[model samples]
Target chain A: MAQEHTVKSYDEELNQLRSMISRMGGLAEAQLTGAIEALTERNAEKAQRIIAADRSLDILEQEIESQAIQMIALRSPMADDLREIVAAIKISSTLERIADYAKNVAKRSIVLNQSEHVKPAVLIPQMVELTKVMLKDALDAYIDRDAQKTIMVWESDKGVDELYNSLFRELLTYMMENPRLITPCTHILFIAKNIERIGDHVTNLAEIVYYQVKGETLDMNRPKSDDTSFAVVPPPANT
Target chain B: MAQEHTVKSYDEELNQLRSMISRMGGLAEAQLTGAIEALTERNAEKAQRIIAADRSLDILEQEIESQAIQMIALRSPMADDLREIVAAIKISSTLERIADYAKNVAKRSIVLNQSEHVKPAVLIPQMVELTKVMLKDALDAYIDRDAQKTIMVWESDKGVDELYNSLFRELLTYMMENPRLITPCTHILFIAKNIERIGDHVTNLAEIVYYQVKGETLDMNRPKSDDTSFAVVPPPANT
Candidate 1:
């Protein structure tokens, strides 16, 4: 009876851990959504709320970390259970990072609101919207232990990178054409970069989910399309 | 006698994990140093080498993670032993991320080499130098289990952030004054941001070290002064 009780309790603990991760994923999604809305609406006040709300995600991550540690020490779970605990820790950390990126975007949006709107800023929301879907799907993959879904999210990141590449070029050209656009455009550049980074983290989540479910590493050389590093736009001929 | 052998084997496993982490840290440091050298020298070939070398760090991180997990499951390590394994996994992942940033800087440096040198590029090497010192100290703190050293590294991150802020302003001013410098300056800007982020990750390593040694969380509200998010550099008045 005691053994059965312990087994039941351990199962409950694992369930609790999953639910906590689910809650974190939901919070991160909301934060990203709020940040995007704030950017699109140029609502600094809402952005401020998103920035402050990031603390909750941070605190939750710490809690999850401790819980996983405690479970590992006491339960001494083997094989798949161990993988699940490790995945929980990694996923929570990735979600916290996602929230950090969202908070950074929120912070940048506040600064961006103070300057004249750059037209390329509109493209960021579309990129972020795609990322948001991937984030949701990645979390769903984790919840369902669906490796196929994780692979789908994994392939989706290339699309986000392609968007970021174009956005990078458009913003650079915009700043070059209008020197007055430089200040605001720089913030836009970072905001887009932050979203792109969030997409990267979401891809990381997909990898984690796949690893936990399949006990295998995803191909390290995933499709990568962000080529802004090599991009060079010559100065306008008149400049 | 069997119990004694088991204990000895577990200790050896733990020691192996520590040594692997140290090696990973050393590789990350070397990668960062090479990246900075490549940037300062505008040596595209050297930058290409650093980019390729990042793969080794990724492989090392994966090995460390699996070794740590194996130790946990096979040994069912308790208390400090478990904490050490967990710390190894987290630290290795952080080092992999540090390497990723170095590779990114290397990629940009290749692009940067093709452009006319921007004067502000000189400041980036200085910033990276400060960050490299912090990385070494943070790793030392982990190996020595020295909370004091971790605290020092934690405090030093602010210096990196300050340098980054100044660099951000200077680059903006340079780009504003000379539109021709925009492309290279943007790469320089990202290189600085990458280094600043490395400093942030070093701070994270410090916290992890402190937690591993003291079995308590550091105050999450460590000093952070990266204010570039709020910064605004208007175009030169004549522009």
Candidate 2:
């Protein structure tokens, strides 16, 4: 808890806040991995567990908010210190959202496992693996406060968006070909979209870290590769 | 800008921040309405205009962020004033997201209007109307610093969720029944989902406003009516 700062108490409080955020990040990482495992293995029980565990994330968020508010009141953090506290608040909320998305994926898994298992659930596992790696790297970068690492993590989100776009088109094609697949396909779409969005939130953390460590927005244009909004899927008439 | 407090400069800074937020909120409200009107009138030109205007929201968000950081650095705001500045930052980001969703809806509308309009865009208009009212009230509550009004706005978001759930099922059914309709229906689903999320962001604003005014989490256990995660849509097998 002791840093190269004059005020030992302020350093300790910030350290406590850091550790809390790390714990929350660890929980979020576990949930992302756990939900995907639940989906891949069709373990409804595991999915249920992940869903149940989300309450902890919510509780942790409240704790972070309380601590951050208390720190602001007591320490009167300015400039970088204020930004640091705000980052914790924002990052915790992002982690909580990531946890919620993981829960949604798990819930979808419960329903997916019960229905006809026609789709191989192929791309999603790959996406889950990729996203988990990204999530891990993003958190690690945050803790290390390595601006370059954060920038790298931020760039990697484009890969997530591209993967999501491909999966989106693939699922829609299946739905258009086989109406029976629409219900399952739609759920899968949401799950994949959830993962994609989780990637976006992780990118947000990376940006916050970048801004905190370096006093500037990462990149002005922010090359977002999300093509989902275009709504340009072909009709698949030949099918 | 003039406050009864001794810090005249601080009061003016806070006032400037508030006006910036209000301007951003106004832009967001117009975007939501413009997107819907674009859909109803089947006007692609109007949708394009809405899409172009999103850059303004993005610009405003950055200004709000810079101003907030500068204020924290200069004023060393404490307690309520700190909360007030933080509220402006959070609310502006939410407004930015709402604006983005509206742009997405407009983008989808351009594609949807290009395709067949078999579904008549039924519940969407009602949902859009409902969300617009919630957003408006949420902004009003923020300006007034009325916790009661904020809570009312927060509770009203359940209606948006209910409407979204109903719209989700309807669009899915349409996609299942008409194979050719899959493309447009999917786009509309995203648009409706976008509007639903905007409502959630507005609820977030209400929560922040309540916290700023009351210095507590508003009543806890927010009553969310969203059951989309339940995944009990009967598989739409009969369609």
Error of 1 at A176 (Å): 0.8
- Residue B120 in candidate 2, Cα distance off native in Å: 4.7
Model 2's TM-score against the true structure: 0.90
My TM-score estimates for the predictions, one after another, are 0.95, 0.90
Minimal lDDT window, size 10, model 1 chain A: A1-10
Q: Which pairs of residues collide in candidate 1?
A: none
RMSD of each: 3.0, 3.6
Q: Cα lDDT of all candidates, in order?
A: 0.90, 0.85
lDDT of 2 by residue, B111-207 (tens): 7877888564788999889888888888898888889999888888899899888888877788877778888888888888888888888899899
Error of 2 at B172 (Å): 1.7
**What are the candidates' individual DockQ scores?**
0.66, 0.46
Q: Which residue runs does candidate 2 get wrong by more than 4 Å? A: A1-8, A76-82, B1-8, B69-76, B232-239
